[model samples]
Target: MEKVFKVLIFTDLDGSLLHRDTFKFDEIKDYLKLLISKGIFIIPCTSKTEREILEFNHELGLNLPFICENGAAISGLELLNIDLPKELILSREKDDLLNIFKNKVPINLQNKCKWVFEMDKKKQSLVFGLEDKKLKMALNRKYTIPFIFEGTKNDRNELSRIIKKDNLYLQEGGRVINLTDRVSKAKALRIFVRFFKKNNKNVKTIAVGDNYNDLDMLKTTDFPCLVFNDKFTLDEIPIDNLITTNKPSPEGWADVIKMALVKIDKN
Candidate 1:
């Protein structure tokens, strides 16, 4: 008899599973539930804060573990009674990262970027399209600082050099550019995949995303999917099992997942 394989899925929330502009997953909610019912684990690997991802999990009624703040930290595994290594947390402390940004980047160039936290409630809402409560949740980040760069190409290059000199990095997501220490979605995904494989040796990993930040994670999985995003194109990836969705957001998410489920059933 053929051995049955356990499937684990890692997904980027914004611009992949949820509508990029509205941030709603209603279109694929039922399908997501169906995947969960079939014992397929869906892990949200995103740049969202813990609070925001937790809220999303609560809304979806999924108790799965999640990677947050661009792989700065992983949480919710305690519910599964799984003990993860402390070193799995890859980013530096939030305050330290912010301080590095302030001290490294020149004040003149810094003036061109708007730090999300320093903005007032209304301005924050205007920039992020979130209301007061949601904006508050987004601000509760522990490891990464999101900002909008309002400078020219040369200014951005200068800022990048300044940040690199301080041992920090920048990740461009669908909405904002994040400043973080040495942490990435790929690093966190590897940790989780190893943990999962220890229990189920036949586990196959699937990863889906829509932006540059998702590149590493997508490349790390057995099955890689790139969801369509009108605002940005994916960087060149050299994976053979890669798939691209024709539509965007919840529609594209549902399509790819359904296809994966069918292929798994066949196997």
Candidate 2:
């Protein structure tokens, strides 16, 4: 490719671009302002909800594109042109998932772990208490719904088969299988890139993340950076065109990314 002034930096939120929690790094605001001043667009791609994305965007004073629900939705930039819904993993009603694993899945999994649980006993379906880490691990591997099961060794194959047969899309994530009938981040990015290319054909694509969920987006970008955050093991995964950080969180990320972008431009 070619060096250019226009660039799109897509980053994951937790364990990649920010602290483990929602806390912002002290220098993040300044770094973001610097990038904005340079005319480089910074977009957040996260597994969070639309409402959460909107709130953060408002806080950051950015009217840029947002990839929410783990790449299920993409919007904001005029040239981005992609927004897809995620599979609707219903959280209310008698969780068929709970009943499906009644024999082996622990009943106290909810109490013992830091994962989101489905509480469908009320009139509406809703997800509750997703801050637990242990539960997040369990649900990350195998998530089940009334009609689908994911996270086995043959998860992709099974999901593909289900999609062919039932016209459904399976869910995949860092800490849980969402079981949504929506689109994946990789697929969504392609859509965005097509539109982005239509306007700025010379723009450089940069992606930063810290988990398995980010693999697709990382592969799709021109430059892929892995934030050396504590929550993830960056060395365990293999990727091409990756930039590892000396520090963690967005503060560390900001320091390195700024330097790298400057170096790339200098050369």
Best by TM-score: 1
lDDT per residue (tens digit) for residues 1-267 in model 2: 755657778887776766755446555877787887888877787776656666567767776677766665566755244332322232222243344334333344323322243433221122322334422432332223322132455544644464434333445444445544345565666666666677677777778877777887888877788777565675665778677776878776786577558656865
Cα displacement (Å) at residue 259, model 1: 2.2
lDDT of each prediction vs. the true structure?
Answer: 0.84, 0.59
Q: Which 10-residue window of candidate 1 scores lowest in summed lDDT?
A: 79-88
TM-score per model over all chains: 0.92, 0.67
lDDT of 1 by residue, 1-267 (tens): 978888889999998999988999998999889888888888899999989987998889877789999999877655434565433577789899888788877789989888888888888888778887888898898898888999999998888888897778888887788888888999999988777666677988889998888889988987888889887775455666677889999899988877766666766
After superposition, which runs of candidate 2 have C-alpha atoms over 4 Å from their true positions? 1-4, 79-117, 120-172, 234-237
Q: What is the C-alpha RMSD of each candidate to the true structure, in Å?
A: 2.1, 7.8
Instruction: Report the CA-based lDDT of candidate 1 relative to the real structure.
Output: 0.84
Deviation of model 1 at 131, angstroms: 0.5
